[model samples]
Target chain A: MTVQTPGLIATPKPRHAPALRLRRLQEISLGYLLLAPALIILIVFEILPIFYGVGISMCDWKTGAALGVEGWQRWIAPCVSFIGIDSYTRAFTDPAMWHSLLVTATYSLISVPVQLGLGLLLAYLLFQKVRGQQAFRVLFFMPYITSTVASAAIWAFLYNPDKGLINSILTRFGVPEIRWLSDTTGIFQVLLKPAGVDLPSGLEGPSIAMLALIIYTTWVFVGYDITIFLAGLGNIPAELYDAAKVDGASGWTLFRHITFPLLSPTTFFLLMLTVIGTFKAFNHIWVMTQGGPGDATTTASIYIFKQLFQLNRYGYSAALSFILFFIILILTVFQNRFAGRRVVYD
Target chain B: MNRDKLKSQLTNLGIHAILISGALFMVFPFAWMILGSLQTFHETTLGTFLPEQPMWSNYYDAIVAMNGAKPCVFDPAAPLDILTREKGCMIVRYFFNTMVMGLGTVLGVLTTGTLAGYAFARMNFPGRETLFKLLLATMMIPGELTLIPNYVFMVWFPTPESWIATALNLPNAEPHNWIDTYYALIIPWIATVFSIFLFRQFFRGIPNELFDAALLDGATHSRFLISVVLPLSKPVLITSALLTFLGSWNALMWPMLVTNSPEMRPIQVGLRSLITEAGTQTQLLLAGATVTIIPIIILYLFLQRWFVEGISNVGIRG
Candidate 1:
């Protein structure tokens, strides 16, 4: 009976059972007829393409011509001898592929936590019954809905080392200009260099350029998280808080026992979304860095894009994307298994 | 009691201080965008935070600078080596193309989504639950997996002219495809799972009494959907339309892949080209960025209520 589960209708049983049976037959056909256009498009574009992508990943595909067949045969078979997971095997050894995956993991690892923490804090602050709360909420949520390309362009201007505002302010305090977008040095290395500490390459962490992207990404998405968190905070029963307060529970205690547990489902939902979102994120990173300054910011999506568009390595790119797809699928299922159980339904 | 009130007041003030600063950080880039767009390139290079005089002409120059863009030209022999011809200010054209794409996609999504949603919510059918579950499962698939294959399909699929030629058994037709066409941009995006899901959820909320009354009046399902259901579902219709259009307007990667033509390019692509081409001309680039985002900002302003409510529903309900 709950509204959360959609697509259930309770139809009262009608008299004249034969007529009702005839009506049921009509309903079945009509239902399918209604669904035809959407189903056709999903099958053609969404479903079939996954299989097509898998096929492309296994072949020595460069361009359509490299598929090396004419007429409808091109559709059925690429006509070249099947490469049989060669591209996938090649990717396993490819350092660039590994680097991109590492970069993607670092991005997700950093931005997701920052966004969740900052979003929850802000949501709790706003939930304190402050005046002008709605206005603040709207302001915070603006960036989430803005076009990433445009917003990233704006951030690029903000991050411009020479004439950018950040550098200008830093220079006023006699701090030197840092290349926010173009710097390839890891942030840890940058922070530690003055102390004569040099971390090894593997331990350097995400590059300064990647850090800038992560910051911008966090800025863009935290609003969504905050808004969702605010909605979650709103859903907890007020009586629970009242009872806890009457039992002499302090603010932190009340939040710990009542609010946080109740908000766990929303937290879990956002975690899943943010994980998937960070992996698939492209527009802003592409605009700001284009996987540049020596591929420091090249997440897996950007890596696949470079292979497909710039290098035209169709088979390899397809293979790389399939690997990414499996990673996301596994991460999602893993989270569902491990994290979903703790969610408070109420 | 007085001390407790004072402590709570201090805490409230501290919270406000934090929230206001956070809000300022969120809005700072947008403020910088507007300021940069109005300044001269020389001033931007010199790190002048504010313009001496707001150069409204930067917008004009940004528009005019778009004239240098080359339309993506593809001949059958060299599909990969896209060529270009110099054109006029593509801002207007890009806007028009984006509008067409947005409107077309919205219409298609709403039609397909509403019909399917209605059927799923209100009617019983064979394989109903299974099909619906399958639709939901597709939502989990990362779009990157589909990108290459979809691009391949768009390029390799036969043209309608070729289809006609083959049917008529005529001499071989030119090798034409969906690349750089409206068909490539609009059609593939129309059948999104999210739209179907959104509509289905909303449709399920409508009371069954309406349906029963309509049935007693001998109204067909289609007639009932059109007359009784749609009229009452205004808010959902608007929500879906807004979302679909916004998504289409904001699309970048897909449009960039399927379209390379200057005329076919949307505002986002045009703005991206500006960034690359005007690498040093920060003022003009910002101006172009400002222009591209204005429509969405305007839309957001008027429909802010629906935007928040719809997004909130997505979080809580989904």
Candidate 2:
């Protein structure tokens, strides 16, 4: 750590090795001192809770109430019994857990694509020298910034079966009043019933209530995708587009050849994020549906919340959360292995 | 050339048409919220697009309901009395709580993030890289998993009142814990990995000559950070502050889980209760929703450039 620029400082270098060692010691202590606050908080809050969750998942803890036990003892021996891996096994075998997982998969599979497509289209349109582009971007991004609870409340009003705006618009077109939030019928079944098409239970898509949630989720998140896409679009060298145009390529041809390939990294990034986001999504769904209309919109997060908060099944809920973590991790790893290769990083 | 000009003008018009329509769809709910907040209950249930006569009273009723006060029986005698007495409304308290929480979170994050970020950026400590890598690894662990255990831990901590009452043998205070307190709300969230990462990157980009000069002047690390580095890092500070404030303000689920009393609830949870309790009072519900989000909307409008730029910049890099 000798000061190399001696002319600038005009101070004699501490060529004494002992002073340098003391300085090194001082630097180490200061570095640790600076890191102490953040490290302590992170370790206590973020890191320990994870191990604590694993421990809790292995217990038979219920409401965590004890007659005489108080303080930390409530979480330890004599109050909560140790039960190894029962909750994990239960989560695996429980039909409700599988159903919730199915609902989550259905919600993510449908909403992510819709969001990505709409976001890409909108970002592409905005990438052009359009007027009021900033206004458009701000308005679209409004939902992302606003509190989900407030927006979900508004959306719930707009989805009111008796007097909702959407149904009003539909009914104006001679369509019947649709139960936007309360309907539990699978949406594909509802849509295809008129076509005399019958599908089995497992093949049924997300319920109408779930479809409403998917739409709401798309509305909240599409703006974020658009912003990210716009950034990605900006990163593309303008020379590529100009070269393509010089070679007599039309706008569509240029986008197809140059833009899409270059945007794959962003697309893949969004895809992974969207999948993870959909998995993590709970606020709007909880606010809007509460996994309601017969568990139609019960994504795994909702189910976990219900179990832990409403039903007081703490141990079981912890196990379910671990299952969810593993699912997200596996999905991410799988995507990296299969989809990450296709990304054009350069 | 004349035909091409006409065609390009048409294309421009078409793009405007599509974008404006999309933008309208994006903003339609906010428009509806504002309009609906001023509507009569009958108008809301009737799906009226606009109110025949604006009902400004709905906002007052929303505030009263949010406060968990007894619904005022409208009397012809004192038409304006209820509005005057409504100064102690819980929504006002919720706003205060939110402000305190937001400021506390911002202060905590800036302090911790800057200190740790400076260490990571400039200091030569053993295990520095390993510790930072560990911090980043925690970001991948989904928050939902930690939530349950965090709740348990929060519940396990003794409430200050009960602990004091027991120690002094003063009175039998109601048994509760840190679940509903500000500590539970603010502490766990302050040390975010993203903020630390953001500060670290920004600090690393600063020229080394400044640090060298500061060291020559015998300035301590804290002194250098406060005097030199912090002044140079205004943009990052604002970005982090705005983001942290926004996050704490809009938080719903964690706050909902932690706080049960209307006295402790932030606006989001309070607005949530309004939805359930004001079952048929759709107008009041919309009014409450509007009241809940209007502050955020105003803040967003004012600082939107930073919001948009900061988000996109972080999105691109992270």
lDDT of 1 by residue, A145-183 (tens): 788888987887788898889888898998778999999
* Residue-level lDDT tens digits of model 2 in A212-259: 888888888888899989988998999989988999997689889999
> Each candidate's DockQ score against the native complex?
0.45, 0.54
Question: Per-residue lDDT of B150-219 in model 1, one digit per residue for the tens?
Answer: 8778987777877688777788656678888888889898988888888888888888878877876788
Query: What CA RMSD would you report for each candidate?
Result: 5.8, 4.5
Q: Which window of ten consecutive residues has the lowest lDDT sum in model 1 chain A?
A: A3-12
TM-score of each: 0.89, 0.88
Query: Candidate 1 versus the native: TM-score?
Result: 0.89
Taking the tens digit of each residue's C-alpha lDDT, what string does model 2 give over B66-183?
Answer: 7675554445686544333353456666777788889999999999999999999989899999999889767666566788667777887777778887777776566668877988
Model 1 root mean square deviation, Cα atoms = 5.8
**Total clashes for model 2:** 0
